[model samples]
Target chain A: MKSAAMSEAAPATTSLPYTDTKPAGHADFYFAINATFRFILRHRGEEALRSCWRDIGGSYYRPVSKQWTEQGMHGVAEYWRAFFKAEPGAEVEVVESADEVRLEVARCPAIHHLRTHGREIVPQFCQHCYFVNEAIASPAGLTARVCGGNGTCTQRFIKRTVEAEAQNLEDIATAS
Target chain B: MIGCYDFCGHYEWTFEWLRQQGGHELVRAYWDEAIHQDSQLHASQLIGEKGIEGMKEYWGPTLADEGAVYERTVTEDVFRIDMHECPSKGFLLRNGLHQYADYCDHCMGWIGPLMQKAGFVIDHEHNHCGQCWWEMRRIDDASPASAPGTLAGTSDVRLRPGWKSPATDHYERATDPDDKT
Candidate 1:
């Protein structure tokens, strides 16, 4: 975790868009995230949960969208690099190039922690990566596609001008 | 992805989103159903089976993991906590994220129902400045919350000069977040 002062001193200089006092976030919060998804799906429906994801990506992450818009692929790469670094137990490799950024998730910290603690994960858990990331990327003239899940996945963020197929929800595996 | 690194930021934002989707009732339901019943089931099981001991078992490692600066006091009759610096609220404050109204109430929103299910009542107060105290007693105890310094001695959060704020919300023998004064 980066300090608030550090983030303030040079917002663009830091890899993470937001900073916290701790080096890494407490993994237990993953429980709440899964539970929140479960509650919305049960009480409202699948659409409502997806809307929640979009709202978070679009509104809550507006700063990130702004950064991605201003700095392009570099901003996306920096953000993911810092993001995975602050997620405890995450084993991710962020590869950035001129046109896109790809995240190779070897072990997802949230899934690992929830599974280790015997928490029942939402089946559509991996879809959140596409919905939320797409919402964030769209505003920056980019798009996100995710494939595989449960324990590992490949996430790619590419410029909207690049010809690419839309993400198929089926391609994202159901989390056990 | 909704990363946990800034969970509180999005968590608070989600509260407002739920309120807009359904109303305050939906937000309340989310806390009881999602948080107390599902997310924190371990806490429920522990406190339900062991009472005060369960609170210690649950909060000790939990608070430490969240990087909270606080103190806990326990006795045969009650379990008390003095939160000098709440990590959750502090994060929102530090990052200037305030999407929900009275984000502090979220604690009671879930914990109150959990404690009620376990046959206990809560006496709690938060100043919205990351300073608060909690005293939990059996449903039949009826003892009011201890005065500053009585329960946690020098660690009493109420004794802090900044503990009193105009935005302070207080509760006494309550099991509902709406029961605050």
Candidate 2:
């Protein structure tokens, strides 16, 4: 596994031209490169993540999947590897956005990688995403997040407030 | 519910041993890792030919829809491996814990010593109970599919002298999903 600092040295493929179907919000995808990307959120989803990258491109065209480094990326990758045992030479599709991403999918790795490593890789992938939902079911129903370590890495942005009647009471006095 | 070639958590140790045998590249495990011992499959030779590409060939059944696939886990770091097997839905084993547990006390018992000699760490995943039975078909069976063996018989997939089954699950934790979430 590569470290989070490992940049995808392989040149990003420009082969995918922006199609008439813009790669925008919750964009219904018709294809994707099947690596670990083939299985995100696939547990119960009836959605067909067809691995159709062949017609669009080549077999070796992996995106230097971020799993080679980042933990959350690793988590996402592991999740798929366990769930989706892809047949090689098989091409598939996934739902994504204009940036070619989504909330209920592989993007979770990015969001998860950010929220957990907020002190490290956050500033990079933390770009504004309009889909993060603050409201959901009980804590159990909250967006489930887990790491390769089997620990919860879900985003829990609960708000808390502290108050004091006397400001001085809150401050520690100097002995001097 | 995780499993290894022999014992639980021995995956890393197994990998280390295979490495010592001169096949530690990730592709080594990927190649023939899925071959049952009965197959006489050569994992090392396969790696020389296909590497990761060869792994997909020996892996499991293909589901028609993407729905059958879960998000695959690329991360592999076994935090623990359980030594216990459920003899049945709730049956328990009282003193099955072996002193050296790199492998089960049954057929693959030697793996423990082999891995130890190779300087790999081993830990009991702390499973004390077990369920014993047999199966002719595992994945597609709606219930425990009967085999030729009697209740005392063990399948190749089970520890010797007992026959329940290892839950087919991933080693890394990334696979623990929230069915309700």
Candidate 3:
């Protein structure tokens, strides 16, 4: 229900790395993201698909990394809070602490929209979170770990100094 | 990860990425196979089954949802859209994100194939500044696109001041992105 005018009227006090005129994005774009993943997976192997995700995380999201590098975990929490606010149908809570930022996604907008429309989701869809987030965090001296997925999940952005195991692809559920 | 708030930014970046991965053929195939066949399957189904009515039904809510400023004109034989402010292109332009050459072509890249499959042809033009006009007709209609002000009257995008600034890419009954004149 958030309209472009509302976003424009709000004070420029947001943590989003990029700015858009709209308050919430057009939800239909989820279709394109899902389609893009499917296209890459079909044409290229899983590794290449992962590379695409990683490349995008490092390239397209460099501004986010820069912000996180400058502001630390507080920036991470702020970014996620602003990000989900602009994604329609997303229900998420971003909790921040001294050491890390955690995002509890109650309803993932992309997965929800794709499933609602009966679109076939790529099984490795959730893995993009690991690859892309890791790429983004690595540059900011942080790391991301995602556990559950397919609708709900816990994503944590923590300092690189914290001793945590590498992400297990199995931890992320296959989206339907 | 890749949020939809800046989908147009990364979406344009992905075009250059895909082009580097394979070539222009890959980019074209991605538009046809992924976009037209996959992401826009609903659009394809609608237009294929209902034709011009489908275009109206689809674009009505879709454009409104995207917050586009435009007018839609429908005749029995043709459907025309005069875009005064394209939400997608406007977003990219506002954000100053231009990663690919002729980002406007992505529209024709996907919509052209869709119209072709739906047995229609397009007479279109875009100024790359978020202003464009499209006229869709049955392939057999054989009539050329109407002159500016003839179809949509003064609301015609082509008649708008600065509509031809910089340059405009025109397509005559084209159903392919490469058919630009």
Candidate 4:
């Protein structure tokens, strides 16, 4: 993998919950993410692993939840826009409207890096977006739905009042 | 989605999370089985195949990618890393994220096992404040770790101020996280 020089500053408009010196993150960490998922799935049962994801979203990402609660969909849109910008090799577009924020992930940096390195992607990899994002959204009176997977997906974060159908796990494609 | 941007935050959190679920043994297992054997398999493969040269190849680009400010010294007998500013630990420190007892141990936890398999042992130390040093040599090499400035000269991390803290953990020709002195 090519090592890109760290950017001296984060984008001015981005509202990241946490801050770092480097503008973009190191892509090699994607290996740890894939490895962590496989480890949890193998050692803990699927239920426990899912619970872990929820806990991470609800707890580790509490700051994001708070932002969404305060700023609503706009905060969600800004967060993702900045988030994807900092991720190396990500091709994502965050579109915002009156009631929701849509994230169209044309290329997932994590999946791309993992595949490029020939790592075995956990089959349930894409499910994390649903479970984790839902946990982050729920406290903010919002809901998240994800469709498509493998390398690309559309994620919608909308007000719970929108009456969207519950996510069907089948909608998320199994990763390789 | 969990991102590489704040990986240290969540990674440290996961350590504490795993500890809460299954205690320290499970954390050790995760580092060895998941991190050493799975995530860092490339490091293991390289060092296993090429020894010290592999250490150079693996850490060279990897540390640069991580934005670490450090120095490396290579010799026929040993490979040394003087970590003046560890990007991973520094991230957690700067973000005020400390979920694990000693986040620094995670390195020894995984690398120790990998090196053991590669027929090497490590002499290392870390101050909770993101400064550390590592020396890896063949297990049969009984040479003690070099004093400050001996291996890498002035670039040695131990020569820097605040290198030794009250909470520094030291290892001597060891290959296990729990084997610290």
lDDT per residue, candidate 4, A1-176, as tens digits?
A: 22337766555556788777788888889999999999989999789889999999999999999999999889999899888878999999999998989999999999999999999999999999999999999999999999999999999998897567999999999998
Tell me which of candidates 2 and 4 scores higher on TM-score.
Answer: 4
DockQ for each candidate?
0.50, 0.01, 0.51, 0.53
In TM-score terms, candidate 1 sits at: 0.96
Candidate 2 lands at a TM-score of 0.17
TM-score of 3: 0.97
Per-residue accuracy of model 3 over B1-181 as CA lDDT, tens digit each:
6778778899999999999899888899889888999998999999999999999999888887787878888999999999998878988888788777878889899999999999999999999999999999999999999999999987898888889977789999999999988
CA displacement after TM-score superposition, residue B34 of candidate 3 (Å): 1.2
Model 4, stretches more than 4 Å misplaced?
A: A1-13
User: Candidate 2 residues A87-169, lDDT tens each?
Assistant: 22212123232221112222233333223422122121111111111111111121211112111112221111232121121
Ranking by lDDT: 4, 1, 3, 2
The candidate 4 chain A region of ten consecutive residues with least summed lDDT is A1-10
Deviation from native of the Cα of residue A24 in model 3, angstroms? 0.3
| TM-scores for all predictions | 0.96, 0.17, 0.97, 0.97
* Model 2: CA > 4 A from native: A1-36, A39-156, A159-176, B1-159, B164-181
Which 10 consecutive positions of candidate 3 chain B have the poorest summed lDDT?
B93-102
Local error of candidate 3 at residue A154 (angstroms):
0.6
